[model samples]
Structures are given as C-alpha cells and as structure tokens.
Target chain A: MRRRRLVAGLLLGLLLGSSQAFACASCGSGGDDPLILYPNEVDKIYVGVARATAFKNVDADGRFSTSGGPTVKDTLTLAYGHGFSPRAFVTGTLPWLRNSRQEATQTSLGDPSLAARYALVMASMAEPLIPQVQMLVGYKQSMTHSIHDSADLKTELDVFGTGFSEAKLGVDIWFGQLDWLAGAAFNLIKPLPHTYDGLRYEPGLASRSTLTAGYVFSTACKTTFGANLLARGSLRGDGVVQADSEQLNHSAFLTQDWLISPVESWRLSLSRQAAFGANKNTARSDGVSLAYLRSW
Target chain B: MQYLLRLSLCVFLCQACSTHSKADAPAVMPASTEGVASKNGTFFLKMDWTTGPKSAATSAATLSFYDANHHQAISVDSVAVVPWMTTMGHGTAMKDQKIVPVAGQVGHFTIDGIYLIMGGPWDIRVTATVNGSVDTATVAVTAP
Candidate 1:
C-alpha cells in the first residue's frame, strides 16, 4: 500500500510539472497532434546554422558546368515565435552570413525578416482527415548597402543581402494520418524598388513552392522528405530590363526532427539543388542545416 | 528549465565568439610584378596602382602592355579595364571611370573611378585590341 502511494505521488508530480506539454491551448485534448505542425500555447525560440557550397554554375543554356572552383556560404540565424492567440502567431529572424570562394572571403550581417501567421482552419475540429490551412505574410528588410563596383569581377559575392527589400505572401496546408503526414507551402516574394548610389533598380517577382512528406518513427522522432521549386522573374536596373536574369531551380531535401521534451526539439536537414530543366543563371549547390528550438 | 536556458545561452555565446582562422580565410593575393601573359601569348599585361584599392572608395590604376619577352612595350588600338570579383563572378560598375590612353605613351592606359566596393580580393581584367585581335590578361589585388 505504501509503494502504491509512492508511485501515485510520483505520477501526480510529473503531471503537475509538465501540464503545458500535454495540454496545448489550441487543442483541448491531444487530438490535433501532427508531426510537423504542432500547435502549442507556448512561445518558441530557435537557433539555426546552415552551410551551402556551390560547385558549378548553370549557364543560360542550362548547362551544369563552370570553370571556377567551389564557393561556400554560411548562415547563422536566431528566430523567435510569439503566439498571441490560440490560432495566430508572429515570428522574427535575424541572420549572420559568411561567404568564401577560392582566395577571397567575407563576413557580414544579413537581412532580418518579420512574419505573421494565422490559422484559417483547424483540421481536428472540423474534420480529422482534412488539412489545416494557415496564411502567412512576411517582410525581409535589407540591412546592407546596395553599392557595387562594376569594375570588380566578383563584387556581387561581397555584398550581404539581395540589395532589395522583399515582401512575402504565403499559405501552408498540412494533413496527416496517425503515422504519416503531408504538407505544401507556397510563397510569392515581391522585391520593392529602391534607388541607391545614383542607380535605380527594381528586382522582379519570385515564387517558391515546397511539398513535404513525413513518417513518424516514434512518439519523439520523425523524418521528412521534401522538394522545392523556385522561380524568379527578370530584374530591371535603371529602367533597363535584364531578361537573362530570370531563374528556375529545383531542389530535394531530407530532414529529421527529434523532440527531446515537451518544450525542446532539434532538427537537421540536408539538401541538394540541381540545375536542370529551364534553370538559368543560377548555381548548383548542396546545403545542410541544423536547428535547435525551445518553447516556454 | 533554468539549466536548459543556461545551456542555450552558453551555446550562443560560444558560437558568437568564434571567428574564421587564417587557414580557412586566406589572405589576399597581390598582383605579380612579373606580369600575366595574354591568352594567346602575344602580349603581357602588368598593372600598377597610382592610388591603391580602398574598400567602398574609388581609386586609380595604370596598365602597361609588353611583348611576349616582357621587355618591349607594345601599343594597342584600344584598352578596356574591367574590375571583376572572381569569387562572386560579377564586374564592378563603370561609374565615372573610363579607360583613357595616356597621351604620347605607347602601350600605356589609365583608369580612374576604380571602386573596389568591398574588402576582398579583386581581379582587374585588361582587354586590348592588338593587331585587329583581342588579347586579355587579368591581375588580382586586394582592397583594404
């Protein structure tokens, strides 16, 4: 009888210690627990680092070979997500970047992004098999100068940001069974026109789409596979349109997520981008990223 | 929770304090005094700066062409100086700098308004029209 009482006391203690873990405010009970889109009541903070190396340049004709050596870029980011309501959240991210190729290397602070997301529909309440839909709006502000010396052959490599501020409108849909999940996200990115250093330039519109599929290995672990497509329009510099600047690229990626506790998780991703099928003026690269997130 | 927070803070601080080492971040390659031979080996090009490169600032440089033996100066019809960042694979803006032939000086040209734009290694590409043919040579320099 004493041993039974001791076990009961321990169970009660655990329940009291991690009440926020099992009870997400959005889902009254534990019914809407998806692998990737975990709607929780707590705020989240994330730190991530990514590295990408470009080994070849895709020419205008879509040929996947170039004469130069590899170029590597590293990015370290800190992000925060704040949930103001049960179905709405806002996020912000700041990044530091470094780029190196051959004998030249540079490091600088990159752009910061702010975004807000709202869940239009929750799948569990309406229909368990249906997908949850979320809408997002975001803006990325350029923090670096847009100036470049045209006489320097590699001037573009030294600059930090894309040289233009961009706005994003996007949507995400996620659906899953008990052990498998699928998701799709699409974002339209529009860069604003800004004049710098006596030159007026406006970048064209761009779009990114990603489709993801995941399998739950256990209650605490999951693995995901995804494909991404990015398309960009022509850029106009000083009232002159550069038609050859448009790009279309595709990449495939794999990721693994491990939930260490109710309030902490870790994720690792690997990706390979190829220059094929209408790709133009872009580099073929491989990338890897690791992230750690904590909630409170 | 307190321990986790402390751990996160420690990780961030350690990462932020780290920097690239010399082996990883190579030093700039200065231009060679021996000069670079053109692609066809018909002429050689040497670059000398009156005012060297400064980050985000304009500077000036001179280009002189020589024969294959690197001893005799050879004159060309026209010279165009293109400053390139080879790593980033783009050229600097022309700005107000135009390649001008030095008066009464054979095989010599001057370029002004040469902006490096950033602190890194840059390639100065010289394209000259010699004997109805284009001969190109490139020299590398670093901007402060």
Candidate 2:
C-alpha cells in the first residue's frame, strides 16, 4: 500500500510539473474539493475563504426589489479529512463568518460540521462511463451566540447559524474520462427546532444541489462551470409561518483550479445568485471563494 | 523551493482582495408615495415622506389610512412605525417612533423620529390597533 501511494504521488508530481504533452490520468478524480479521494491520497487539509455581497432582495413574487443597501458577508473555513479505508472517509470543518452592513457589522464563529462518506462504487479509469457514487451523512453543531432579538432585522442578518443542530444527508456522483469530468451532488439539510429568545424557531428543511462540468486545459490549469440550486421551506415561529421566510434561489459559478505543486492545489470560484428568477424572500448575491488544499 | 514560491503566490492573491470595509455612503431616492394594505385587509396605508430619504438620520412622514373604497379615511386607536431593512434583517437603532394624530383629520397621522440607520431597501412597517385588533402593513422605501 505504501509503495502504491509513493508511485501515485510521484506520477502526480510528474504530471503537474511536466508540460501538457503528458496524459493527465490523476487530474480527473482529484480536483473537485476532497469530496472524494482515492485510496492513495488519504489525508487532506484545506483553508478556504469566501466573500459575498447581497445587493438586492427577490420578493415573493420574483420581482427584484433593491430597497436596502448591500450587505457583505465573509467566511473563512478550515477543514481536515482522513480516509479510514478505500471506500470510506471522514471530514471535519470549522468556519468563521463576518457580516457587514451600512449600519452595523458582526463577526462570529459559525457552526462546525462533521461528515462521513462511504463510496458505493469507487471511481476507476476502466469504467469511466459509469459514475462513482457516494453517500454522505453529516452533522453540524451550532456554535453561535444567543440571538438577543429574533424580531430585530439586524439580529436576523447578523445571526449566521440556525441556533440548532443540523443533520445533512446527500449523495454524490462523478463521471470522469481523460481530461473531462462532470459531477452532481444533492443534499437535504434538516435543522432541529430550538427555542431561542423566548420563541421556538423551527427552521424549514433546505435542499442544495449542484451540477458541474469541467475541462482540463493543461497540466496545471483546469476550469469548471457549475450551477447551484437551493430551496428552503418557510421558517415557522412557534408553529406559525414567518412572513417571507421561504426561499428558492439559484446561482451559476465559474472556478479555476490550479495544481500548483505535487501536494498542493488552489481553487478560485466566482458565483452570482438569483440573477433572473423571482426568489421567495431571498436576496441576490455575488460571491467569490478561494481555497487552498494539501493532500498526501 | 518551488512549492514555497507557489504557496506565497496564492497567499498574495488572497490578500489582494481583502480590504478594510468602510462605511458606505447612503444613496437617497425620491420621496415614496406608495401604499400598502394591512395583513387582514382592514385598511390601506399610504405614505408621503415630508423629509427626503436619508441614511444615518431621521425623517418624518405622514401615514394616512384608507378604507376599502380607497377614498374614505379610517381612524385607528394607535399607530406604531418601525423602520426596517428587510435584506439586513434589522431595524433602526432608534427604538421609539413618535406618532401624532392629525386633529379633525381622521385616519391621518404624522410620524416623527423615523430613523434609517443605513442605506438600502427599508420597509416602513406600520402596526395599528384598529377596533381593538392589531394589524400591520409594510411600506417599502429606498433610503440614500
């Protein structure tokens, strides 16, 4: 097993260091965020930072309402992963968030999440047409301060967490051949209702799905385009529907992945959300994310 | 050596985008004469801002309540105004809004101390006690 890992790492190093003439056999399975890792590369660590600005609100009728000044949010995440076996891995992630508006600014630590994934069908070059499938179960523990005023608009914007523990179930599928790769992932997040500030806030179920397609342009460069869809049910305040709490929004993103060295890579992503449709009680936002990863 | 150089380059790129956030100037818009209906169809509240929309300050406006016909003025027991930024999910720092009934002009009230903390889309949420029942209506306004 150790010999196999050494050979794989050496080959990946050569592929990334050499010119584009060499075939990129290791590039297809590795670049898409350590959602899936092969047997050879077991341990992974990453630091990711993202900035988003909410420019306008999409009313319930899908109309664009630019009523308020923009709100900016920044997030920094640190994650670690280890493969327990060839078909299984576990990951833990922690994030810090800051929200800024014209009137006030807030900074706090976000929820910490732990996920366990097991592959049903491991990816292989021999059957590139058949996608590799994996099922993931994750849990996020709320680590935010108590919400002082649930009815306050600033409190709502400043509070990053749901103030409740959340569970996530998802499936990920990937298909790759040569220099082209594609993947799809869907997740359902359920946040347990919790009483905060003298009110029971039952957050509605939310689902997030993504579709991605990428092409390897060269040994060091790869670009991916993806579309993300997020749908959330209305939040209930003491079993009553909170006004304008439901949301359905979509965003398109472009990402550039650079394999900088044998053991390190960087991904930069730009995204625009809720551009055309009428989203329910949601704001339109543009975001950028930069991630640095190291694996061995 | 090569890996260190690449890591340094990535760090530099990330730093280039990070900047200290400064307070943004408020972008004021024209006075709003928009109307919003109560939650239970009790009445429609029409708003006319006497002072132009400005952020980090207070403005005055007159809120007139009209019945279903939109022609007849309707009187209420009490009125309260909350200046809220919907996108930000917060209201102004000023906790109190002063509302005075226009004498002999039923359903017409002048509201003062409507503070807008910042620029953006704001909802002037008016909650009134009519016939011993509380009803609320939201008027959308843009503050500069």
Candidate 3:
C-alpha cells in the first residue's frame, strides 16, 4: 500500500494549500470599515492588509445569546504620518495580528497608536463647501494584552488592544467643492483607569462615525472614487474581566483610489459590516482592502 | 450576496485541516506559583514571585510598581508576559512567549523565553506601564 499512497498525497496537498491563505486580511476598522486616514496634506506612509470574514456557526440554537457566530481576522498595518506645521499633524501605529475562530489561531500585536491632527479651516474655490474643521488626538496602548488569544476569559471575538489605557478625540468635516467632496467624521474613545489592575476597566465611551463621498477624475491616470457610511457604539464600560464587554455596530463601504506615480498611491476597498440594532458580541464581518501609499 | 460568496468559499475550503506538526501543535505544560500578585488602590502593583513557569517551560519574575499617593515609583513604560490557556481556549504561540525588564532592577522583571504551549488554566498576564498609568497582574500558574 505504497505508504497509504504517500499519506494520501500529503492529505491532498494540504487540502489544496488551503485557499491560498485567503491573503491574510485585516486592517482594523473594528466597528466597520472606512478610516484609512483622510487628512492627507502630504507626509504620509501606509502599508495595509485587510481580510475580514465572519460567517460560520450554524447556531442551530445552542446558547450564548445576543446574536451569534462569525470570526476571522488579519490585520497588518504600519501607518505613519508627519506634518509638523501648516495646520499640525503627527501619527503613528504598529499592528500585526492574525485571528481565526472555531479553529483557533492567534497572532499578536495590534493596538499601538499616537496621533495628532489639526486643520480647522481650508478649502477654496470660492468656498466650494467651507467649514474646514478637522481635529484628532489619540493614544492607545496595551501591546500583547489578550482579548481572544491570551484569553483569561472573554470571548466574543475581535481582539487586539483593549488592555486599557485610551484617550482619543476626533472630528473631521470636509464638504468639498473643488474636486467633488463630502465628509463627516466623529470619534471619541475613553477608557483610562490608568492600569495597575486594581480592578478598573470601564469599556465605556466608544463612538465612531463616518459619512463620506468623494469624486476626482482628472484623467491621464488619476481616479478617486469613494462612498462610506459607518457607525459603532459602546458606552458605559466595565470589563476588567467581569466578563468583558462592548458591542453595537453598523456598516457600509466602497472605495477606489489609484494614482501609481510621483510617490505612489493605490487603494481598493470593499466592506460590509453587520450587527445592526444592538449586538452584544455576535460578529458579522466582510472586508477586503488593499493599500500602498507613500508621500513626501 | 451570492450566499456570502459561497460562505467565504466554504471558509477557504476549510483551511487544509492540518494534522499536527507545528512542533507538535503545542498542548501540555503548566504549573507554577511562587506567589506574588498585587494591585493596590490608586496604583501600587506587585508580582513579587514566580520561577521556572511550566506549561512548556521558561518563566521568571519579580515585581513592584508605584504611584500610590504620589510617593512615586511608576516608571515601567511597557511589559507583557501573557501565558493564558484556560482549558484550551488557545494561546502560547511559543517563541518563548517573551517579557523582559531588569537593567537596573526596580521591581525586577524577566519572563524571557516563555513557551507555555498549552496545558491547562494559566493566566500569567503581567502587563505593566508607567507615565500614563497602566497595569495588569496575574499569576494563577498551572500546567500539566
């Protein structure tokens, strides 16, 4: 029996090489897509990877209420930013995570940030749509602090940075008039019991909002198209392991930005996030993103 | 949407059902508790003990953090020593599951070369941070 046909041909070539690893995707956007930095005024660097999925768990009525099923994450981001003057700017991030559900797979590092953005006004063309107001501040820490892998007890999926110590403020409003534009952003995340773990984790205060629309087609290899609508919520937190919590979702997305020269910029995205009408932890993901941007 | 793209193409054709060989698919080894775990009010961290952590081996410890009433002692910056394996929930990518800090030794810390590839009930967590106040303490050691 020729070694059982060579272990059945190596288990059929590792089961057909397992769908090419699904290109390992995940570029954070946790509450549902849209947020690949849109305050570009030069000085940027981005590297992306997004592959999200959540749909598997027949939930033939077993238990664990509040809607259930879905899990698969892959996030590899290394965003950067700099713009000392001209309305201020400063950013940083370091992420590397790989997640899987039901089968159990966990890779670490994600949830490392330092941000600053400012530009309260600027938009001409006889004021295509003025009101310029963009402000952002960030600080998120807790590297290698489990949420799903290290699991001390807290599983609903989506894990990366939540070891606590956050303080971020946001606002973005751009209603362009010069190349067709429309934007709205609102962010606020606060959870700073200032760890020493004397028991303090109020996953409270989490808000993310987005509403964007873009258009720029200047032929000759220049095209930018966009559309987004996102929402996420979490207020009144408490999870230093009293069960760990936070949930509420909404989603929508569509994008395409390509201009492969003079510094390079390429983006292609598609999203569909779920968990409408209050979802405690039950996930619902669908994502695909590709980015490669560099600027001077 | 086309049945969610055929259920993500049947979950990537069920990812090649690996039959074990990532260095034996980690699972087994854990048990250690030299005692030492603290988290006082307003910040006063403590871990004070642990050595030769099990569940695959390599573990060590000694700790103390401060900021209690501002007497001062909170300079930790960063530290991570997560082991965790709660009845096979999954964890321990093994690479020694590192965590180091000592240089001057102010509450010493070293969980270098960790590899608790699984076993049972292990919550080694030892997150420490200063200058923005951050803290975590866990040493419920156990493995076998």
Taking all chains together, each candidate's TM-score versus the true structure is 0.62, 0.69, 0.26
lDDT tens digits, residue span A100-216, model 1: 776677777888888877788765623546677778788889886433422233334555666788898888776644357677778898989877556576777888777777776
Residue-wise lDDT of candidate 2 within A148-243, one digit each (tens)? 243443224556765678898888776654477678888898978877546677878988777777787866787777776778887787787766
User: Which window of ten consecutive residues has the lowest lDDT sum in model 3 chain A?
Assistant: A18-27
Query: What's the lDDT for candidate 2?
Result: 0.69
What TM-score would you report for chain A in candidate 3?
0.27
The order by descending lDDT is 2, 1, 3
Give the top-scoring candidate (TM-score): 2
What is the model-wide C-alpha lDDT for candidate 3? 0.52
Interface RMSD (Å), each candidate? 10.3, 5.8, 13.5
| Ranking 1 against 3 by lDDT, winner | 1
**Which lDDT value does model 1 have at B68?**
64
DockQ winner among the candidates?
Answer: 2
Fnat computed for model 3: 0.00
DockQ of candidates 1 onward, in order? 0.04, 0.04, 0.02
